[model samples]
Target: MSDEEWERFLRETVKDTTGAPVEPSARAREVARRLREHPRQAEGWRTYSPARPRRRKVWYVTGLVALVALLVALFPQQIVGWFGGDDGGQDGAPLAAESEAPREAPDAEPDLRPTLAEPFRGSPAARWADGAAGITVPPAKATGWMNAAQVERALKQSRDFLVAAGLDSDVLRGERPTKAIALLNPHQKDVQDYLRTALSSKKPDPDTDPLLLFSRFRPEQTRLVGDVVKTRGRLTYREGKRGAVEVTADVTFVYPVTPAADSGRDAEVIRTIVRRKVVMSWDDPAKVITEPGTMSLVSYALDMTNGGCSGPTGYFVPPFGTADEQSTDDDRLIDPYDRSKPVDANDGTTSADDDCATATRS
Candidate 1:
């Protein structure tokens, strides 16, 4: 209520970083007077330091907001509320924190950076649906070899594989792709075995890199920002060369991840985009002894953006700030987000080890 109380409060509450008691200075007295004289002037408390670095400013604003809340709670009687008069809000709603708001200073830009709460804010994936919903199937039509219903079944099965391979939480966290492989016809043991070895190997070679078929992250190194994995792409079907209906899935999956749970609140969010072109055949029962409801693998291709090249070759390693994609004299940088055209399949290179391209964004 009086100068004596204010001084006593400062002596008890305030401290320097070194833990030394901080006696309120003349500037603190002036700032206190201004806060008391004009309550709305409390809005000016946001303007902490004009020349501080952007991140420091964020921390400063956050500190100021927390301090205000503490003061309001601890000294509701003594501290004339800077937000309102001696009487608080009618409903007694607690004060809101403008914690991370940029101070009102020159070059004080708002933190438009992506965060765990809004991982895909500035990305095209923001508009995409989460997981398999984005892989839209075309209206089923009778292919030359199969009926409309068979074609639709093939498309749905193809989508299931996509979901398991890329969107499954267990698969993404570097687990086995059992669900994805189950969709395959058991007769195609060679293909299934190839996939198994691709994952079973601790370190894969160029042709057997499991990332080409599955989206996986090293759990010890990084973790998903949230449970959401935004996806967008299409599914189509046509007559296959082997007298079967071939369903093709062309889809892009975007994942936002951070260094690990221990990484602080402001940890950088790395966006890794994986695009796959998977073809599955609805085999002709008359010609082949196929399972009643199974799709056989025809062929597939993979393209990725922002997955670093130098990490363990088995899984996709999304780097902290920028992509660590390796470039060779024969390889070129490509836009991972640009799905305007199909990947140049004729290049004959099989893996990132053979034809790694640096990404523009990560």
Candidate 2:
């Protein structure tokens, strides 16, 4: 065919394959001229060559690889999640966003020991008692006889008696009424008998015997005298089943605990000043008994740092000695009323010695 006819034929063939009319651009015309010049070679194009197919396949594979790499970089977490690997974030969440999420905080510890307030005397007494001794002078009549000075004197007498008796003040410091009663028995036979009979009764009540109130309550285990900072007393007369004059003493002191007891549990040792009330009843205003007994133990109450009072455990009785003889193993007992002489320890042996002799009783 002629050059012009050959170009027209090629354009028509391309238009048929592409389904569009071909424009004769410079490049298209040049390609057409080359095909026309190589007619013998063009005849071979009728049979397909693997060269074009191979090149197309190579480009397709390269594009697919680039797409996969982009997906891996952008959705690493999501890819891991699909394959059952830990994605860190919750289900279906993006890793970048989940990484910046805020976390919840843990709970705090609670306070075990709380702060306690100082004790006061005006507070209600812990224990009270009405002895077997009949009330010859009832509370109403005894009011005229009782005064602050008289009550103060009575309290001092009681303090002196305790110190003189060499009573285990530590045991008395606790709440044990029975132990206290036993300790007082040798000294105050009348008081001891009264307490035993009253406390052992089937219907023992604080109302009947005020000292029974300590059955459930007690002061802290500590030194009572050494802690005493101040002491004051007042006389009160209240009418009840039996009339009696009441002498109340308020003692203020610094509550102390052993260094070992106050360790890491508390940052610093806290010694609090507290006040306690001691009440005693006088059944007969006419009779002049010893200091503490003249005013019987009616009520004794105090505040404790740790908690309630633990009653008396036991008492230590010191051995007695005389100029004529050596010391004996037998415990020297004394009458709470008369400290001048030493009595038997309920055991039959009674050996009076110089140790039992003291100027206070004389």
Candidate 3:
């Protein structure tokens, strides 16, 4: 056959889809050359281009290493954490708000020691209202025979007398309680004559002493620590079976005193706790011919804590800081600040019972 006829026959017999010249691999040529080698193997043309030379694996390894380096540069902290290095923080480890040293817990106990400036600091009286404001009177209602207005007037008069007798600065400074005395009925000559003798007398009896009627401190000796006085109590009133209105006041007074106001702050200040319960009687004007708006003193109960046992009845001398703190040998534990206890009448009031006892607190 001619060369052109042979090429046309090859093209027609074995088609080349790429439109390029057809070629054979060495394996295919060898297979065709050696018919006896293997007759069962399959054969087919895969591509039209010539095979490329293989590249080394070193380039692939280098590319992978570069990718890892780029990631570490961008996220340094995350990279360090993966490697478990530098505690996963900048410079060193992470810091807390207070990283210097562990601090100790603070003390829980309160400082109770009294000072001239803070006399009521540790005592229960610290929370009490100051002066006359502390004396709280209940709402005046019509009690039995007395009208509401009369009841209110009687309550006010009772509170005024209490303020004069116990809370008045002048009375506390060894001055007579004229305001308190004027509130009492002049018909109470026994109570009046007794008060007159008690105030002037040098060695008065404890039960009927001037101190029983009022509170007084020697101006020559100790002085008040601060301008304010702490007080707390309640006033109550009721009409009795005899048709007379009875008004009573129960109050607690806290007086902080030092040798003098000029004394140093560190100097020990003494606290005098006095609880007084005074009874005032109002006779009905229609039934009895008595003074108008005047109430007579029926009876009273006074209790003082921390006063000197042997001191004279009229003046108060509180135990000194330099002396033994546990001066009272009596085991009778009494909380002077506790107003819940019943009012003590004749114990500390009578001359024979001039004794001291252990106090639970200042």
Candidate 1: tens digits of C-alpha lDDT, residues 1-362: 89999999888775545686679999999999987898763336557645656898889999999998898798764455345332321122222221222233112112346677778755545545677777788888898677788777777878888998999999888999888878878888767676777878998877678887789988988899888887777887788866888887778888888887656877888788887887788888787667877878777787777677774478777767654747656556666666665854411127744557766553
The digit string of per-residue lDDT tens for model 2 on 1-362 reads 89999999999887788666667899989998987898654446568755545788889999999997897799875666567553222222221211111133111112122112212121111011111110112122324355556544544454443322222334334333543342231434555664565545544332233222221212432322233222212223443224444544333223322222222333222222223344555544345343344445544543222211122112111111111122233554321212122222211111112132221110
TM-score of each: 0.65, 0.26, 0.65
Between 1 and 2, whose TM-score is larger? 1
Displacement of residue 213 (Cα, Å) in model 1 is 1.0
- As a whole number from 0 to 100, the lDDT of residue 2 in candidate 3 is 100
Question: lDDT of model 2 at residue 357?
Answer: 23
Cα lDDT, all candidates = 0.72, 0.34, 0.71
Residue-level lDDT of model 3, residues 68-110, one tens digit each, is 9998898776667456543311222222222122234112214
**C-alpha lDDT of candidate 3 relative to the true structure:** 0.71
Clashes of 3: 0
Candidate 3 residues lying further than 4 Å off, grouped into runs, are 1-111, 323-330, 346-355
**lDDT score, candidate 1, position 93:** 26
Give the range where candidate 2 is weakest over 10 consecutive residues by summed lDDT.
126-135
Model 1 alpha-carbon drift over 4 Å, by segment: 1-112, 321-325, 328-331, 346-349
